[model samples]
Target: MQESKWWKNAVVYQIYPRSFKDSNGDGIGDLQGIIRKLDYLKELGVDAIWLSPVCRSPQDDNGYDISDYRDIDSMFGSLKDMEELIKEAEERNIRIIMDLVLNHSSDEHLWFIEARKSRENPYHDYYVWRDGTEGLPPNDMRACFGGSAWEWVPELSQYYFHQFSVKQPDLNWENPKLRQEIYDMILWWMEKGVGGFRLDVIDQIAKEPDLKITNNGPRLHEYIRELSKETFRKGDLITVGEAWGANTELAKLYSNPDGSEFSMVFQFEHINLDQQPDKEKWDLAPLDFLKLKQVFAKWQRELYRTGWNSLFWNNHDLPRIVSRWGNDKEYREKSAKMLATLLHGMQGTPYIYQGEELGMTNAEFEIEDYRDIETLNVYHERLEKGYQKEDILNSIHAKGRDNARTPMQWDDSPNAGFSEGTPWIRVNGNYREINAKQEMADKGSVFHYYKKLIGLRKTYEVFADGKFELLLEEDKDIFAYTRTSEGEKLLIICNFHEKEVPFLLPEGWSGKEEILIANYNEIAETEKLRPYEARIYRKA
Candidate 1:
């Protein structure tokens, strides 16, 4: 591995522009506020920041559906503000990665507008469109947001394809010319000194040529490999795919040097603790622990050969892992710290979302309080489908990933000090006690643990790119893995449960030990991890 590349062993902090900070006091966050807080990010000890999206968008999907690729939305600051932010972040040794939503464009995009205008229009071929056979969209595929994947374009009298919201139409990548358009835009931003892009829904981007879809179809990788060769070359950029269905073999194909595509791929399978991989098929029962241990162990062992995994517990799109995976009522704090220990101490690059450092969790919200377009749409769709109102509400409570996207907590003041006025969305009620201002002051706080964890990655070379070997995988609720490099080994042991557990160190591996990092209530030795406490034992 190249030691100089900024992306390697780097920790990424994701910022949702609308919820990060508000300078205008309009109850919405903008660029100038982020500029003022550069030092704050620096203190968090992250290598880079990835803003959700700041482009011109209808925000129906809250900036996921881009109307203009090059222009900055007015809600965010101007293009000049972005340029300045880049310069400011560079000064702090912090790189900025952008969210590249290339899978689709907003219905209002000029290209989409023209495409809908007439069948003979040149822009008509920019998106996927097909002739309707019998007053129905030509396929059985369901949209991610819960409806038909096809929407009728009355102006052109044809059906356009969209894997997500109908307002966001999928681009035709099979058209080589369209592929070039995306590549050109990528280079356009790279020229601006932007570091890289997190490709949204990469697995969904490349579908089969025959357009066969029943949940998931085969031949997905064939198209992705072809697309990778055409767009992402060997050098000049780093591409991280939001790949959902990638197995270890495919991961290696995309992440390895000869893999042709990107640096790493985000497989959410490990994070889907209680989730049914397919949404159309929701399993109401709670997750089985033995099943989870097997799942993660299999992934850790299998994916090691081909590609690097993207480790994370919370992001803009999912509910907090603590509340979902960990027993929130019984073991909130230990569970949070245990989850962190499991993720950060792993072999791959870890991404810590803005409030995740403080062990921030899902916001308690009434069904009516949700502002997420997708959640509301799902509720309505389920209701219209004759599902019980109670069942729909329960699904929202359990499966609503938007709960994690709520605004960050900066202070105990109103709106968590996010703004002087009402926020675009309500802040989590626990913000008063859980804000960054408070965590920075407290010694044993979760925020402090994050700072120490980040420092460990930078200070210890082994923790960053070290070899991870899964040990004691059979133990339920205890995730023990060894990371070693240069003949030195460090064992990371964590008890995921609130109850205490004992562990036996490997035989013939005795050495002088130093505690590099721990997440326990009171500090303890490496022989046994207390409750949610995790200890990293260093060899001397």
Candidate 2:
């Protein structure tokens, strides 16, 4: 809540533990595996690590289905391993942030298990339940993963709400006792030295009795305020909420200057700019450069003083950035570096997903190769409707979540040096060319460029706390911006296209400008930007 919090200066790195590295030779990443990679993260210069959910689960939706919030899953080692990871990460000055899935819990969770046994059970009200029969759901709302949002339970002659899968039941925030239980669990983790939490789909936590409507219910802010006051507020903690479908206005309300709720909220406007409206993730469209620029500009300018922005390009649940937005085949390194420059140059806390620094691309696997439950469900559903196999596979290749879920490319060894045993999912075939070991060895690599970008953020106050102003707003191929603070100013120019583009200098800025950082060695005297070229100029 303070003006000078540690998280404000952090460059967060998100680690999908299952794919980060396998230490026990079990072909899956664990807490101990993360412990082994602490030094690597420290060397990369990230200030915080956001580990996805690792609590006890049925592995139905990876670790998002939490059966026991207090204990660690055997697949991810134990509570002791997590404690050790916290201790080790603290030693390296890297704060550890847990992914807190507050919206739902695994069906196997004790509270959900007891609640479904009988209507009169003490825990019966912990989850949302309604009386209904099979195929006659209580509402017409579709689950995010697909199908109806309600699942029938024969034992209690009711249907429980599950916005994701039937195995994960949505918790009832209306119950005071249920809310208390969540707050207590948060306090438990806070006491364990966990720096903070990345709240999973937190806006969806507070919902109306009717399951048809989307987020932003009547009590959403109220519930978040109560949760903040009761749990994380007692300790100095950072909270970033995954606010699905949130816009700049709503985001400002969730994270105002008063810190009533979260430290910041991850808005989806930029990420969803390429998606076809009202269509599934597989349905795609070309990203509107103008719209993308507008969205970023709006967030930066609107949230300048009151709220903060969480800048990112790739995450565990999305396709790789290089493959999605850059020329992954030809200009992979250049474009990846350029994107990094553009993102880190902005006035926000940047989050680098694992392998992003190495210019890792999407895993263009076949239909049968996917392990994501959502992908499989959609694939089968399309198959039954006589949709061509090749068409479905093409969509999967373009937009499937599994594209970003591939195992980390540590080195060009067996299984990309990710594990000694067979990996749970196939590694990207390009690992041989783009691995951390190779990038670390090459001075002119994406990894080093990221290191430079992060160093710039740490050393310059303009990039972190300066006011943002969008430049070249009408330029189709060149994305430019300026950051101003006191007497210093930073000018960032990025070529989003693959061809050469002319960038005219702004008026009164023709004076001497020092090049702070760039993706290429030589700057064009003619003011022409090469393909995917990014440059940061400073004037003091």
Candidate 3:
């Protein structure tokens, strides 16, 4: 049997600081705002909090482009505030997980500034640079934000590569000095008592741009292993890598039993089901429920004991789960709870995005209301491609990252109680009906349902170490599975649509079962589940 780890069963709550809460009416959420909410997170029962970037930045890529790794941005707060937050959260038994963006740095970073000065500068090799052929870039490779990936720097008479925005230059992992600096920075944070880290775009760090290779590079595992030995291996920390290109085979190398790379990787195979396989994310396609089942089941079964998995449906870069997969209109609460049950029942560490517990739906934003860089870039790119404004808007409404960046709904007050002043981003208009204050006051709210799910994971070992087996694989409207561990068997059934569905017990399963948890108040023994209903049963 594999040895136990704290993060194996722990629940992580991801907080996008800018939208969580504002302190001192700054119109932006800060470390102090998170410190103020530690008690609330404790009540919600999350074991750790994954805070997005708070480092010094120019707001390019929303802090992913770090200007300085050693200081907090003034827009959020001071370094003292971060220290206090770490201490306060520790007192509440909640560990802080920092978002580490090691793949790139802001163009304003000291090293980048120095690198652009001249070719003979010691810092010139700190970033990926190549001599342009004739007058154009080395190749026509496109940036993630829609232009040529290579940007011209006249001072050096060369081009620097950036996988993302031009302002965020990719760091050269081939530089040993840069790697040492990163290791030292990580150790500095760990010494300050952070519980873990979430590596941003980690898989792309060893990218071979010259060969047109972006992720899962040839030296990827070698670099990751070196990183583990130099930093993560030194402490009992939980590390999750954002590997959009990782598959089942590659995931094993990342989260193998030896723990040489990371604790687990955040794979997008399941999330990309609704996207056209050969096209960009903006290209819409109906989600294939069967394919979704296959993706989840394959990962769950393959990584059962060989590696680990990170379970999550909502995050800062994606649309709300309730709005994307479930019926967010009339069956909002029911579908939210149903989706939570389906994911939490799997064997992995669950992540709950801020306000996700409140059943927060996607924002109804106009073109002018969008603030995310990716969203705006795609909107304009689609328009330039001659796509209709309505079609582009509809796709943005369905898949825009801004949908997840709206201010958190705290209460039915001015600005959703997120800020006393105008918010940096527009608040979701439905905050009056779906806010934390209102949900916490009602026992039947989605907030309480999520609280129960978090508690169940801690109380039941089956949820952590159980073997997962998908049931009713061909059923279009029902996602059903069974988890078994140490003579304990749990049958989880979820009705995914807005219609009644009959769930017949699989062969060898007896009718004498105890209801562990259910979304509906009354569940009839007739095996007929109502719209968006979820039930977990244990054989009695």
- Best lDDT among the predictions, by candidate number: 3
What's the residue-level lDDT of 320 in candidate 2? 89
lDDT of 1 by residue, 1-540 (tens): 222345666888988888889988898898888888889889988888888889899988889899999989999989999999989998998888889887789999999988888988888888888888546778677787778888886656788888888899988766777777777777677778786678888776655424564222464566566656654552345568887777777778667755456778888666555655565423455666667667666666666646677778778877777777775665666677778877787767789887888777787677788988767877887889899988877777666766777778888988888888788888888888778899889878778788888888887888766777877767886777788788677888777777777767676455347778766545654566566666678884
- Cα displacement (angstroms), candidate 3, residue 36, comes to 0.9
Better of 2 and 3 by lDDT: 3
lDDT of 3: 0.91
**All candidates' TM-scores?**
0.91, 0.97, 0.97
Please provide, for model 3 over 1-540, each residue's C-alpha lDDT reduced to its tens digit, 9 standing for 90 to 100. 122478988999999999998988979998899898889899999999999999999987889999999999998899999999999999999999999999999999999999998999999999999997546998888998778999998767799999999999999999999999999999999999988999999999998998999888899999999999899888888999999888889999999878788899899888889988899888999889999898999999999999899999999999999999998999999999999999999998899999899999999799898888778888888789899999999899999998999999999999999999889889989989899999999999999999999998998899998999999889999999999999798999899889998888788776567887899998777877899989888862
CA deviation > 4 Å runs, candidate 1 = 1-4, 213-236, 276-284, 327-331, 378-395, 509-512, 521-528
Report the lDDT of model 1 for residue 46.
89
Kindly list the per-residue Cα lDDT of model 2 for residues 1-540, writing each as its tens digit: 343466777899999999999998989888888898899899899989999999999988888889999999999899999999999999999889999898999999999989988999989999998988778988788887767888988878898888898888999999999999999999999899998899998888777657465578778999999998888678777789999768888888877767778889998888887878988767778989999999999999999987889999999989989988898988999999999988899877899999999999988888778998778887899999999998888778878888888999999999999999999999999899999999889999999999888888888888878999998898999999999999899988899989998777777577369898989997777878899999999998
By lDDT, highest first, what's the ranking? 3, 2, 1
lDDT of each: 0.76, 0.88, 0.91
By TM-score, rank the candidates, best first. Answer: 3, 2, 1
Clashes of each: 1, 0, 0
lDDT, candidate 2, equals 0.88
